[model samples]
Target: MISAASRAMLAALALAAATVTAWAQDFPNRPLTIVLPYPPGASTEQVARMVQPILQERLKQPVVIENKPGGNGSIGTMFVARSPADGYTILLTTNALMTIVPHVQAMPFDPLKDFVPLTTAIRGILGLAVNPNVPAKNMAEFIAYAKANPKKVHYGTAGIGSPQHMAGLLLNREAGIDLVHVPYKGGAPAANDAMGGHIQAVIATISSTLGQHSAGRLRIIGIGEKERFAGQPDIQAIAETVPGFEATSWLAFYAPAGTPKAVVDVLNRELVFALSSPDVKKKLFDLGLPAVADKPEELDKRTREDHKLWGDIARQMNVRAE
Candidate 1:
């Protein structure tokens, strides 16, 4: 026999679920906005633009791309974090915001708790490029050269605590070489200094160094991926020289915490479909970003793991944000 209190509890639960289902069915009755925590024309923005049309078409609503970049992505990220949990405002950010930034500075919201991971949209492979004058063609040669000239060779990156900086730090630790790290305001300046001989090497994206490498102005030492990226197979993976070496950046989507499960499912299914389209894949590949669509649970697990991994690396290296 069902007691009165037990039946009432069951009825309440059922009513709440039905309400959420109805909300999901009515989602995006208005325009949806994707807040990016980086400036316009960035890799994140480009990837968002590529997927916007697909999302708009599938959702039958205008999808807005808003740039809210600052504080190494914390400013805009926090904005999205505090937004209403209506599934109308989404966060499109890089792994840096979730994994790298928190280790260096205080954030207004908890990365692990303030949002729900939707999916990983794209992955970017970092590459090590050296000026032609440096006596190295691959990771082995580069490591040997740095070893021979301890404290003499310097490498530039976007900034301290940036992914490129972490890649440089990891390389130094794993290769047991001493390469003085020189921080720049952005990757462009770092690449410029490398070309002008101010720095011997630069750890930046493959796209940033590809043109110079092809022109023989810069020699790519190695790529920071376990295997050569399919988009550019000529470059060898750094792991070939240093076993298990891998450092790649990625972008993902998220919804503010407390969003209904039904709304999340609808958004995930449609966006994953958008990311997996052939045309979208080609466009991303052309821009040096590979389209990657993983399940929500998969993205959630990866985010948590990277949060710890980068945090440990930062502490072990004594790296701090500037």
Candidate 2:
């Protein structure tokens, strides 16, 4: 019923739409690189490796992981921040890089402006634990013990500005305790001290000490979360005792800013698939990490809110460079 000219125009429009679709889908025909901001064999690498194989299977392409750690994740973060906005390069990073690093450092790239959200890989819990030699059996007892013996109970942090530092600072402010902080190069050493009874306590990833807690080496007092970790249900949350106190952290993926929406959508869909698989969830759970697959918008909102929250807390408690 249509005239030839009208029919030709309609066909042209259809072709254009098809071209856009193809353009979007054609991306990532090659291997994709996921830049990790942590060192090799780190938690970030483990999470990346766990999801990368599944994503490769689903996409029929490889998702490669590269470690570019240094300067408290600033170096790797900036590398990803400056990468081409073509979805070929992605960043598997912790919220600490987004929420904690920017507040404390003069960075080459802005965390909020330089990246496009892919998806949050996981939400992990952190716990406050002490050597078995400490006289505190629980949160209340620990606070009382620290209050009675000030500066005697030393606490170890992963680094001066790391999440362990944030938890330690938050704990001190909330529990009204002035525990001396000793910074280590990373979480392993700080946790080692806690297990060896050298330092009284240390705030670390639940997975970092899950083995110790299981082996009955260190005494876990409180978790910096609302609920008990599935991996460590015996340990109560700090919120239960501190009432209204909570500090949860996570890891997520981000593409360079201005990456195509179609590519981002594809990545998000694959991540959802990865999270839904029982194998993937089990790996994370065993590592004491809770799986949380968030859309791009949800991740953006949470990161922004955390930045504000941590900023205010750091300021109120006078948690400055150590």
Candidate 3:
């Protein structure tokens, strides 16, 4: 009872489905590559290396890592986005490149449409820390001090449009204070400046400055999570004082768009299994990046939500990268 054209269209769809299924079934016949958008020795690269053996063992393929660092991770990210959807070349990068960078700069690739998220591998919480010279003991006193000082109080971050920078901007809006932003080449330098009293405050990963905080070199006033980090429960969350401030950073895996669902599922399964391993979990935790795993759809949802959230924050703060 169907027209000839309709019958032909159905036949085409069925053929395409079969083709994709066969392609997925034959995936990773050779070596697989994981591209990192940053230089070697970064946390992202470390994580990729940690899971490389597991992936190689499970898939029976050599997992090669390529570092194509430049343009704030866009160079490498774009490389993965343009790769064939054969699941051979993958991307491992931080949430900032996907969720925040696009909002602040002109990117070569579309974050939402160009790639399929495999899963989030690990996450870390950012915190606001101040030099011991700052007359602030906690979030409340810090807010009060900033209100009194205005432009006189300065905060340093890794760079403009970085997660730490965004957190500082959010704090400005949420707490109604002006904390001047000083951009540095990296978080470690920023934290070092804060400790040297060259800057009054710094928004950095809690672990990067935790030792300093414990030694009285820097004082961590508030973390950028809704709740205190389980690893450091003694520190209060910024949200506890600012009501809705949060800035969590994470690393995730992705494949080029149009990748078959079956192939994506296979990668996700291996990733989840590797991340759930006890040794992997302990290593990630020791590095201050707690391992996490989720379904592809969950990662997609989180990516979309974070994309929108960061866009809103960037627009509200009038933040644009140069």
Candidate 4:
């Protein structure tokens, strides 16, 4: 028994409140899919699975990891980009695919416009290594051999146009060495080939190769970081030999464009929190994959930076799909 005006006003307020709550709760009503452009066993996949549970715990939804690798990482990216803007499908990718791919080819979608960048999850540093049996024991010796042999040494990559490929290409151009480019279906295979001596050398991420480097199956001819890997500071950085050389492979998460800002913020906060957790950080650190979280704006900046940087390197090296 209320007046019509009072009842109407109460209903309007309740609807408004419900709409906002619905907007917040409206997201993630179903199983969310996070797409990985790389195949299984990739550091991107490894770290994504590491944090997947944390996100699920926070959101109360099961996160399904989908590996859609191929087309130089375009297939998975395009799939996520074209998905509904309801924040269900996410793209977990590396710098090479998200930023460097467009520079190398005309992709079906614009990375910046088609996807809402979620955040940078982790960054694994790159290292240039060679099999123990190769004539080159160190970076200088390796360069000497390459210079003398010229195109005889096969350089392995995660795949054509991948960051590992770009790293090798950049090193070749900078050092004026001609190493045969060999692209594998994924980084693990490329690393395995390099470790098995099937290929002469590989520029692989620290996370994938550090174990062998420690085990002595592979020798680090040169590393591509400003500083040496911890406990191996005497090993020397590639920049030490060539000067101005540093390349790191990174993993990032993204969502379809037009997703509600509220949902994006919620995920970002949870992701950063999960990454900073001692357990998560320790696990990744032991795996040689360091946790790196960048704000959406910072990740965007890095994307632009890497696109320009890798594009220049690719153009200079004349790197192309092979």
lDDT (C-alpha, whole model) for all candidates: 0.89, 0.84, 0.90, 0.81
lDDT of 1 by residue, 14-126 (tens): 99889888878998799999999988877888888888999999999999999998877888999989999999999999888888878987878788999998899988779
User: Per-residue alpha-carbon lDDT of model 2 for 121-219, expressed as tens digits?
Assistant: 887688898898888889989999999998888888777667778887888888888889899988889889888888989888887887887787888
Query: Candidate 3, residues 159-243: lDDT per residue as tens digits?
Result: 9888888888888988899999999988889999999989899998775788898899999989988888787789999999889
Superposition TM-score, candidate 2 onto the true structure: 0.92
**What lDDT is reached at residue 272 by model 1?**
93
- Top model number, lDDT: 3
- lDDT measured at residue 208 in model 2 versus the true structure, 0 to 100: 82
Supply the TM-score for candidate 4: 0.86
Pairs that collide, model 2: none
Single out the weakest 10-residue window by summed lDDT for candidate 4. 226-235
Q: Of the pair 3 and 4, which is ahead by lDDT?
A: 3
Consecutive 10-residue window with the lowest summed lDDT within model 2: 313-322
Residue 306 CA displacement from its true place in model 1, Å? 0.9
Clashes of each: 0, 0, 0, 0
